[model samples]
Target: MKHERGLLIVLSGPSGVGKGTVRKALFECKDTTLQYSISMTTRSPREGEVNGVDYFFTTKEDFKQRIAENKFLEWAEYVGNYYGTPIEYVEKTLQEGKDILLEIEVQGALQVKKAFPEGIFIFLAPPSLKELQNRIETRGTETEDLIRNRMNAAKEELDMMDAYDYVVENDKVDSACDRVNAIITSEHLKRERVSNYYKRMLEAE
Candidate 1:
């Protein structure tokens, strides 16, 4: 039997929305066949961040060259650092019938939507703006000025939540992961997917 193409699950939100935390929990809580797409960046690696695992670290020139060659599914520059998702790996993974999760920001997610409209877009949101600020401050990773800037960006990103197929509130990591898992399961059972499966079965028979 021929397997159907895997789902492209795009999980995106503003900074400090706990998208990463929820994604990690989803992986741990489910035995689903999924792969996490590792993004490429021109920024220097942080402490304890492995080269290939955390990000595919590259030089500014190399990253720009790839962008010129249209290698990225989506690319963006934030805080003077270039970050992008390489298209090759993601396409190969989908063709192999393994779902892939892309944990990205709002802008990149929109870009992906244009390139691959079939992908499932899920927006992770904070319970409230105040809670979002608290989460950002709690991280202690950014300066006051940077935090403020992120908050501004978050506001703009939150406004785009309607564009996503599903909006998941990240009030609690476990609950958020549960919602995400449910969405993925539901997407797999979508009419289009089921119809393809049914057609394949009839052909085989």
Candidate 2:
């Protein structure tokens, strides 16, 4: 039987909407089987962050060279650093019939949509804009000006929710993970995805 290409699950939303927190929790779950597409970044690694596991750390020159080569599926610059998804690894993984998850920023996610419309896009939204601001404020690492800027960016990002196939509220990490897992399972079961498998089985019979 021919193998089916795996699903590209993109999870994104406003900056402080907890995309990373939820993604980490989801992957830790025993039932989660999606392979995470490690992102490439020009930023220095944080404490306890492994080179390849956390992110593919690289220099600005190397990252820019790849961009010129058009090797990124989606790339974005933020806070004076570059972050991008490599097209090679993602394509190879999907061709092997193993689902891959991409936790990215909204702008990068939109770019991915243009390249792979069949990919599942999930928007992780905050309960409310006010709550989103609170989350950013809670971090306490950003200066007041940066917080204001992030709030402005969040508003614009939230407006793009219509582009996503699903909108999941990040009210609680565990609850959000449940919703994300359920969405993945449901997508796999869609007739359009599994119909060919059933047809092949019938033909074999």
Candidate 3:
């Protein structure tokens, strides 16, 4: 059998679009070979969140130092904290033939697109702007000012949805996850990937 390179899947969306929830549901599928790329963040861990599992929690200074060293594939500051994707881990995982999912903000996602143009970019969107506002408000995680800032950012992100390869409506978590899973499955079966496998088989024969 010919070994194939793993697919890089980038999932991005506006805040309160339920991207995190959909990602969690996607991992529940036992048949998936997908791995989650743990992002590095300078924010304090929330209740029930574990270090290295949820995020690689670090101090702002350390995170800034890493940024200066060009260690991150993509990174951005949201609200008051820094979040970034470490390039080394992601490259190593993909080399091991495991598809990895990166759930990040729009700015980071665009940065990844520039760095890895072969990646499959998926945009998770809310059913409506009104619904998105409601979801953010219901979470009660941020103050009014922060929520307003996020909403403005969301509007700008939505305008860039055309740049993504796929757009999944996150009205229902299960349904959104289903769509994302289908996309990954289909990407694996793309003509280019299958053609490479066939070529390798012919070469060996």
Clashes of each: 0, 0, 0
Shift of residue 44 alpha carbon in model 3, Å: 2.3
Error of 1 at 156 (Å): 0.5
Expressed as tens digits, the lDDT of each residue in 20-67 for candidate 3 is 789888888898778999999998887787998878999999999999
Q: Model 3, residue 152: displacement in angstroms?
A: 0.8
Each prediction's RMSD to truth: 1.7, 1.8, 1.2
- Candidate 3 off by > 4 Å: 1-3
> Candidate 1: misplaced stretches above 4 Å?
46-48
On TM-score, the leading prediction is 3
TM-score for all predictions? 0.93, 0.93, 0.96
Record all residue pairs in model 1 with backbone atoms less than 3 Å apart, i.e. clashing: none
Among residues 3 or more apart in sequence or in different chains, the pairs in candidate 2 whose N, CA or C atoms overlap within 3 Å are none
Report the C-alpha lDDT of model 2 over 9-86, residue by residue, as the tens digit: 999998889987898898899877789999999988856778888799999999999999999999999667898999
> What's the residue-level lDDT of 17 in candidate 3?
95
Please provide, for model 1 over 74-100, each residue's C-alpha lDDT reduced to its tens digit, 9 standing for 90 to 100: 998875788899999999999998899
Native-structure RMSD, model 1: 1.7
Error of 3 at 134 (Å): 1.1
Error of 2 at 58 (Å): 2.6
